[model samples]
Target: MVGRFTRGLRVVDDSVDVFRDNPRLAILPLLSLLSIGGAFAIVLGTALRYGAVSSVLTSDLLQYAAIFVAIAVSSSVGTFFNAAVVHCAFQYFDGKETSVRGGLAAAWQVRRKIALWSVTAATLGTVLYIIDENFGALGSLARVLFDLAWGLLTFFVIPVLVLEDTKGLRPLLQESGTAFRETWGESITASLGISFVFFPVGVIGLSVLGWAYLFASGVPALLIGSAGFIVLVAAMVAAQVLGMVARTALYRYAVADEKVGPCAGRNPETIFPSD
Candidate 1:
């Protein structure tokens, strides 16, 4: 387990090379964040203008529908931009020049598939949310376990949908699961390693803000807190971008069996040394 964690950490660290090569990859997630945030703002504004929230809350069916719509929209937008990120990362691996426009174009080419997959994801997510809210402690545990399993299964689905010629959502999920199973250990460990690295930085940023709040006041505290918040957000965004790059790298190495560009010169054992 220790060995696998180390290998995964290396993969996460090496992903920095891809980020440096195409710093603009970070822009994809920024676009996603803006798109989703804008969408939610519009929804909230419309709901407030029409008093839709109270009506929706009055009926369980309406409440679930509202949740479904929110999840569906957010999932669709997030998945679309994630597809773009995977597309760009694949191009980078192939040693071809890539741009944000090119990545967006690639994702556009598979818009229908992405949409279908997003709806499926949203449906399951909504069901889980309902279960979590309605059931007691057992429901919460089930939701957590199911969510973890779903995440692992769908880890490679975006890449598959964007890069492969899979026909339908079922096939997409199947392919993603197959790919994940093939590279299960290293891929999962890499994801965990990313969380391990970023979680502390976020906590430290909050800790600094807490200290400032206790020791300083007025403009100084505000400045310190503001700066810390900005830094924390930047770190979070960078972490998301690095995760996509690392996923692409791992997919290329484990699934595609091609070790080019950022993956070159590293043995497969480097990522799966225990194997």
Candidate 2:
């Protein structure tokens, strides 16, 4: 019942500290982004060139199936790097030496688990999206609520999967759900606070960059858009990294019964203070 926003912010600060301690941990996420984006572009280009779009637009089955595959791939890649980040963060928390390559190697060792979990998660996610797309207003609202709950419940799944390779999706999901049930306040605030702080900045920066399209010709407009996109992506990457690191710190505290880092040293109530 310790739902303190201030405590959550402190957890966030601890995560930033971890990132500062080992900035290379963030590189895996960047690579993950590039890989996912490349896969998406390849699929889209192939689909368009081969007239898959003709069927996709007309057939619900095709559309939903395509959505499932794309999301599954993207989730798998994203989860891979996120798990990698968690592993690296653990090293940071332990005061052990680690690198992005080492983290990637650890994550690679459990690639199959990551893929399985990603598929399971992606299936649920795709179903939610389909419901939202087809069910009109009610589906949209349901999707919003469902997505939030799903995110909360599975927030620790990647870290769990990385740390405990023997555990299957069911056990990992259960552990993730249980961890959040116990530390819901700190977990929710860590992510929510970051989003609340960065979303506006991203919006404002994009708006300024978007304005370039109005006044600049051709290449300048492209440059402005690309610059804006990079900034936005960088913000998102930072947010995800911080959240994952905080979650790592929490996981160690909650499950491992070890409160070694700054993140765990702080009280839960202070993270998001009632005041």
Cα lDDT tens digits, model 2, 1-275, are 33444555666677778788888876888898899999989988999899888899999888888888988998889888988898888887777898988888988999988888878877988899888988999999999998888888887887788887556777888988887776676667777766766677688667757787677779888888778777777777888788788788777766765764545655654544423
lDDT of 1 by residue, 1-275 (tens): 77766766776677777888889988888898889889999998999999898998898888888888988898898888888888888888877998999999999999999889878977998899889989989889999999999998999888888888999877888988887887776677778777877878878788777878889899999999888776676677777877887777777776778775435677755556435
lDDT of 1: 0.82
Candidate 2 Cα deviation (angstroms), residue 272: 4.3
TM-score of each: 0.89, 0.89
Best by TM-score: 2
Q: How many angstroms is residue 252 displaced in model 2 relative to the true structure, after the best TM-score fit?
A: 1.2
Best by lDDT: 1
